[model samples]
Target: MSVIEEERVRGGVFKDINAEDEDQQPTVIESLCMTCYENGSTRLLLTKIPFFKEIIISSFTCPHCNWTNTEIQSAGRIQEQGVLYTLQVKTKEDMNREVVKSDSASTRIPQLDFEIPAFTQNGSLSTIEGLLDRAVAGLEQDQPIRKATDPVVAEKIEEFIQRLKKLKEVEKEFTLIIDDPSGNSFIENPFAPQKDMALTVAHYKRTPEHNAALGIEVEEEENDEKPGSDLDTMRNEVLVFNTNCPECNAPANTNMKLMILYVVNCEIWRSHRRAGNQNNLTDPSDMSRDLLKSETCSVLIPELEFELGMAALGGKFTTLEGLLKDIKDLIVSKNPFMCGDSSTADRAEKLELFGQKIDKIIAGEMDVHIILDDPAGNSYLQNVYAPDPDPEMKIEKYTRTFEQNEDLGLNDMKTEGYAEK
Candidate 1:
């Protein structure tokens, strides 16, 4: 390519420019300002990122409308992958870690039920506290919040704010989880678990639902390259909530299925007969109504089916490998039922075969789904804004009817052995 030399200086500078080759300045391109539609107000800057990759950071300020906009675009080919970064905020020092969250990153505080879902804001580089503060600002500035008719929701949000403030003020501990499909988001941890760092980072496959929201599905489709499989449009996303067990009223499990219980046998339902005896503060007939309140939710696995029985994996699992390990331990090794199955050894061989298939699923050699039917309504899969949640996350709620309640022994006879009210 021929080099263009511009000599605007005097004779001495002109000779110098003509004598030696000068490094070409980054070509700044001008365009119609996106904000105010003015010519030459917008400037596009090209810069090299780490690894010698080129990228354009565009900035524009409109003098007429006082509008300003800035965006970063990769000039080189972008890598396609997903990432998850988790930080355990133990003290004030841990909260000071720098966080670079892309606009597509989804942030969640699992303990708080707080998630700043994807596509809600622009990319940002901030501290843990700053992210929390940004969430507070976003919640406060939301238009629906100001016009809300439901006092309960508004009150709950206020409570959430207080909890966030307490997270910084007090020495409260919580996990900060961030996920990004474009793989640009990060937490300022050691990025290695064996390094004995307090942080744990896991990278996993991105869901088509996530891609659709970020406009990634369309871009790759136009390129005639398959981004991924065409995800089931019926439900592209599902929220699996971690709730107390409805049967035993125990908080021991999340992402559990009644089907797993049938494997050996479930003890929860039998334990439910004594549920009212534990705490019968309300009228027997009235307290039974709580069993009727139902909500919908589904667990999103995007890549593999989670077939595990973890008493310890907790609520949020950002990757399939971590989840698979916990599950593999439960099925292949443990007598999770707590029952004396050792007295009968006829099923040992069958169990081994079943575990082998499970290993295949985790190894990505095979794909299958396991369904969890939680009757307690403790879990949910909400799609308030998403058009398609995820197909594998099909959730069905079963509420006990009055007849079913009667069969459970909430009959006309009270403790006094008389007709009930």
Candidate 2:
């Protein structure tokens, strides 16, 4: 071959080898700055930050922009390429070597011990058959043949005897006695005599002194009248009265007065039933009509006296006559038939009857005073009575006014009165 041709061929072969080497080598390029264009072709010396332990460029220089900064761009661990050849050589050395030891400890087997009780060598079935044969022979013989006892049987009997001895050693005896106030007595002996015996007996008896300080006298029972005995039979009977208001023409408040009468009867019955036999009556019929009159008179006279004073104080009426006139007029207007019915008359009679019965029950023993706010004033009229007054009377009045406003409309003019008493 010509020299020039050989040189050209060698040059081509060298060019092919250089190309293969370039492909096999890892690619390394300059990391670019995203914000600005800069030919930073220098290799970045990356390392981890000291305390923050993040990725850092240990050193770098921008070739074109000439920008030099040591501060870390990305805050993370810097993972570099590992030494592959060194790792392969170390692994191969570990595989080729074999571990050796000069001395070793000897191993020994562990020993254990257990205990088993000795047993007889006799076969279980043969032993049972021999016992049965002996028993059968003894039963068939006319003579009383003694049967030999097995060692096991003897041992069991001996154990039972030992158990009995132990029980006897621990056993104890006790006795108890109880005596009652009514000449009654109880006695107990936990361990009783097992067999009868002949014995001599002696008794030494001593009488205890009757001490006055230790004795207590028992109380005797007494008979006393029970409560409500006088009025209990009068449950069905009540006296009612009917009247009218003359001025306002409203109901005369006779029912209201009757309610007051009931209250008075309840109070009297509760207070005086246990007082004496003077109030008691055997015949209810005999006391019926008379009882009605007295009770009404007693409650009405006092209640009217109270009403007179209350009326005068409240400026409602000047006298009892005027008050009665007004009440009659009111009743005539509000309850025209209040006094027209048999039921009304019956209720009036009942009220009178209850009053009379209460009067008899009280028997003038206790003064039946009508409690009044003013003892001296004789007013003819009083405010309406309510048993229990509402605590939220004011709040209810306000709520009712609002409800009226809502119903009547804001522009509508209307007068709202107090809620019905």
Candidate 3:
């Protein structure tokens, strides 16, 4: 071949290689900026993280108003079980640990009793100190507007922002918790291949509501039943169903007894609370019974004047002691505004006292009457004396009132539809 032809062939090969490299780089596409209502360019990069799954990172910038935003999304499917990570930040070095916080993950700081609710911020892959810096910047961004309109609120926020900055210094030990129902978030364990003493990981089964939030359709056993079935024959029958433990996702069988009365003449919804008699109220050590508190159940303690609504704790198939422990944890540790807001300081103090009383009840030190009122008639407190009625326990079943039906959203429901226009 001629020397000129050989040089042209070699140049063509290098040009093709350069084109392939350009294709692998981030793609800049036209996007509409929400801030400026102008056309912007978004650079999209699909890449895999080391020791993690694939992710897509997008950076949008608007030249009109200089608006910018960045977000990260997991390219993989949702995990089977949810995950919660608890890391104890005891040293300044811990602030440098890497973290992968998905958009669905909720973050909490136990020392400040502050929380960043899920979906409030975009997913981020950054160090602990970087997260804090982002939070501070976000808070400061709105300070000018707040100071102009409401100086009092802005002052409180400024003080809270300073405290958030101090957390990066690690002057005091604090617990950082990241809870993700999608099971995609992570915190770097400095000790790889071995367990890090400062980090604790827990896997939990996602609830039906959580599944719905993620746009997942979960198949329920109740949907298999026909429109009309034999109601009398199903009474007192122990219905066994499969479930996983919320904390560990271990397979378990939940046996539910048919205790409702659906008689032809009178429809009575059975809702029972095994209350302690005046004499037995002094001793609640043996009161640790299996409790199935449905989402519709409301718990009340008349003596303490404490009434916990149905939505406060959600559904749980745990023991009485376990339920009390959960209540304590929710109020004392997971309170979001416990430290920042001044108005809640008084309420926080009361909650701390209430937590102390709950501890006494758990330890069988307090005399309080616990009532589980379920308008839907789904809650159950196991009877220690199975076949016979216990002298210390009282059970009642009555028809629900109109107000109760309204609260349950049953009044708005039309079960027997015409299916006609």
After superposing candidate 2 on the true structure, give the runs of residues whose Cα lies further than 4 Å from its correct spot: 1-315, 324-345, 350-421
Candidate 1, 230-344: lDDT as tens digits:
3333134443555533222223334432221222223454322211111111121221211211221122232343322211233442333444444455444542221232212
TM-score of decoy 1: 0.38
List, residue by residue over 350-406, the lDDT tens digit for candidate 3: 767878888888888887777787767778777777888866566676667777666
Q: Give the worst 10-residue stretch by lDDT in candidate 2.
A: 100-109
What's the ranking of the predictions by TM-score, best on top? Answer: 3, 1, 2
Tell how far residue 243 is off in model 1, in angstroms.
Answer: 46
When 1 and 3 are scored with lDDT, the better candidate is 3
The local distance difference test score of each candidate is: 0.48, 0.25, 0.71
Name the better of 1 and 2 by lDDT: 1
**TM-scores for candidates 1 onward, in order:** 0.38, 0.12, 0.48
Instruction: Estimate the lDDT of model 1.
Output: 0.48
Candidate 3, residue 39: lDDT: 99
RMSD, model 1, all Cα superposed? 23.4
